[model samples]
Target: MAVYSYSKLETFKSCPLRYKFTYIDRIKRPGEGIEAFMGKRIHEVLEKLYADLQYKKQNSLNELLADYESRWKANWHDNVNIKKEGLTQDNYFEMGRECIRAYYERYQPFNQAITLGLERKVVFFLDPEKRFQMVGYIDRLDQRPDGTYEIHDYKSSNTCPEQTDLDADEQLALYQIALKQAFTDAKDVELVWHYLVFDKEFRSKRTPEQLEDIKRTTIETIMQIEAAKEFEPSESSLCDWCDYPDLCPRRKHFYIIESLPMNEYANETGYTLVNKLAELEDKKKALVKEIDGEIVKIKEALIAYAKAEGVDVIRGATKKAKVKIEEVEKYPYAGTPERKELEALLASAGCLEDVMKASLDLGKLAKAVKSNIWSPELIAHVKKFAVRETECSVTLSKLSERDLILDEEMSY
Candidate 1:
């Protein structure tokens, strides 16, 4: 029954655990990324510009920049995180200022289109029964002289997506749906994204058919969310920007101990254990070559001794080394042309399934299960014969200075 936004849908897609923590549990976390802060500051400036234009008061570039600066300083706090190395708050502030400047210089006098609304709140149903509802705020709504309505979204991010991506974007497109529903003359609606950092504008329009399709897909997504029982965490590079790392099962330990002082961190139990294991592994690898060479020589000598003595077993004080000879068939190595042809022959003979059943690769089966490559029914059928087990592995990598300094300001 909760009113959903584009961000909510996106959060669910990105990380279901995060979605649960945010919208379901309503957990409040202090601090936010500096990138978001800069975007907000830029959005506020643009909102003010459109709002003032409606009141017949046009603000100059300097006035707008001053306003932006004031807002930034007022809202700036110590907890605002800057994740990128070699970037300071001043860099972001200047970037935001430049964004405002670029926008102002490009669209001075503000007359290309009539400003209809600023930070316009839009709520609309994705279904006829009004069951799945979506809400979003348009950065600026404009109606041009030709009666073409434009839903404008402001982006302060440095990277501008390709046109193809914008064409498929759903946020402004959803707002367009709302615009059409609200205004009768909104037939010719355009979705516009102002990439302020790049001083660029991208435009796309959703066809009636596309709108209907999106609604259907969105409703399906909502249904999936509603029916979800286990909201598993999806970890990716984006996890670095996630706010609930401390609550995430995969990241909790790292979150808890990452801020410890070097002395304490070095002595930490898990760290020391992993370090010792890695050290032992390195020593093992270094000795493996020499040991392997000696083992090969001894094995050859043992074989000769066993053949000369006509004995299959050679005994020491308390142990016996058995030399047993057997012939084994070897097929063409996997991925080779011969192997492929052999596979094709077997498949043509209708023996592929039986062969697969005879020597099934559990790794491949597990991968298929994790990737959901099979239907639910097929997965359940296969899962009946499989017992889930946890496999722990340790990989060694030299820690960077940045890793040691992760969340240096994190207290709790």
Candidate 2:
């Protein structure tokens, strides 16, 4: 009975921990970035534009731009952080203005199709049993004279997606399912995306099979999410935009230390103590390596001196070292008669399993599995009796020297 939206499912797919924070735990953050702020403002302007058109009055380009600027200024706040470098708040404001202006000019008079609904909310079941319901808002739904429906979505982003990407869009495809339910007589439904920034429109149509496939995949994804016990944080480039970083285990320490006051951090003697300890440890490692090198040279000298003195043992001031030489035999050729005889004897004694030469090339096997040359069931069967060993190692990377310098500077 989980009702999901496109963004909810996408959030879970991006990072389960983030999804848990937003949906399950419902941890709210203060504010969003300027990009999101601008998108919201533009969406509002567009919604107003369509809403006004329903009243038989079309908003002029200048009027829409004026309204956009007014709303942008009224809603501007300190929490709207501009992430793009060298861009001010005014720059983004003007950019949104241009987007609205361009969109207004492109479809002026607003006579493309009869506006059925503006910013309309649609809900449809993804599963046959009506267990999983997906809800999303269509930016604009229009109808043609031939009973064709178009689901339009507005994108305020600067990036324009490719045709294949538009074709594979799940949001509109899911919306198409809702459209079918809402309009039973809807013969053909077309998915349209208006890239407001680029002022370009992309249209795509989905087959019934495609919608069924999307439903099946969406249900499988939901099943996986329901079956998940541990919501592990997924790291990617998108982490920079994530709002739950302070709560995430992977990023908590960074923010915690970052939030510490410079005076307080400097007053914490443990910080300096740890820094000194790390420096000493690094110096100790170098000294140890040097000492080991000298030991090797001394051992070489001792061996040569012992040979010169024609003695088997060298007596040192504190220790005695002995050099022992033993003769051993090796079979260079595995196909030799001795090796064959040993192999035959071992095979007869049922000990050949210990000496078997077959090696499991795991990398090749993985590639075969990925390429569908080997079935996962077969791999699982082989892995059923597989033994695994865990290896643990300790490593230390020195903290940034700049941070240490900054901390010292702050102390002054």
Candidate 3:
């Protein structure tokens, strides 16, 4: 049985290759950002506060701040990197302290509900078959005097989520199932989040139907992860903070060049060459357009002369030009009399399928066959009556000026 968590499911959705690297391959990287370090320390302080409350002992604000500072100093290490620019390690450390102090002030005396568990681990089966298990830890679980359960989570980030975002939260929704199972009398479970940095609290509830929908969606996501053969990397702004950049095939080159000297990296192989090629390609397209306009004007003059002389073909030094007119049939509307007549005739002749099949884009049909959306038998049937046409295209080449001049002389 595969175990799922909110982070695990979110990781796969954000980038399947990252999930594969973290969960499947079990690649380990050392060190973490200062933000995560601060969050952990704050979570410890909050957990301690609740644990003391469970014992009928209230921790004063000064006592809590003292414990927070002590832990912050004790766990501070060299590997914790600061991600924001122009900020030192002390800035984040103090920021976390301020968040804890604000939280303590807002919810002082800490006796809102009866404490059930601190940093409680909850696990529940998402399906009746019990093939998929969801596991997560609630920051604080409490029961009110009225027997309503509350699942609390703490956030140390500077930004607070919107109300709609909290309403759609999956972690607490999954926890609701565990709460219902653990406490048979549990009713009207509420999801609560403390945005510590902002000293704000958000609450929402999930209906039974919503929880069912979440279960179905989670199971479907897990099945996708199980069936996925190619876990392609998804590049985004978050790649900068990814721990496996050196191991990732898509990002390894970037990390390697980032370590190189600026001048050397700038002149690295194909770096400037590709840029110059792009510039030259743009110039070539502009020149082609100009030359095509001149060619059209010359061709028009030749055709006018040929028509005056009652000639179909005009011979040049090394090539010949001919003027011809073609007649084409148009069916602009489906409700038109001509189109209706054609449709009736085709239906009576039992060739409507052939006409419909012929109207399909051959390239898209071939792609559908390749992707197994359409079977080979269908492709073979279509091939029996399909007509193949070849088209030739010409484009300006990225050659030296001297070589282009020499080629032009040879053409004449």
Please tell me which predicted candidate would have the highest lDDT against the true structure: 1
List TM-scores for all candidates, in order.
0.72, 0.66, 0.69
**What C-alpha RMSD separates each model from the true structure?**
16.6, 16.0, 12.1
Q: Which pairs clash in model 3?
A: none
Pick the winner on TM-score between candidates 1 and 3.
1
Whole-model lDDT per candidate: 0.83, 0.79, 0.80
**In model 2, which regions exceed 4 Å deviation?**
261-412
Give me the overall lDDT of model 1: 0.83
10 residues in a row with least lDDT, candidate 3? 388-397
Q: Rank the candidates by lDDT, best first.
A: 1, 3, 2
Writing each residue's lDDT as its tens digit, candidate 1 over 1-412 gives: 7688999999999999999999999899898999999999989888889899889999999999999999999999988999999999999999999999999999999899998998889999987788988899988899999999999999988888999999999888889889888999899999999999899999998999999988988888898899999999999888999888899999987986888888888888888898899999999998998898998788778777877998776655334577765442334556677656555654564544543655534455556656776567655644554444433222224444554454354533
The number of clashing residue pairs in model 3 is 0
lDDT of 2 by residue, 75-117 (tens): 9888887767999998888889988888888888788899898
Error of 2 at 368 (Å): 30
Q: How accurate is candidate 3 locally (lDDT)?
A: 0.80
Mind giving the per-residue lDDT tens digits that candidate 3 earns over 127-194?
Answer: 88889898989999998888889999999987789999999889899899888877888887999999
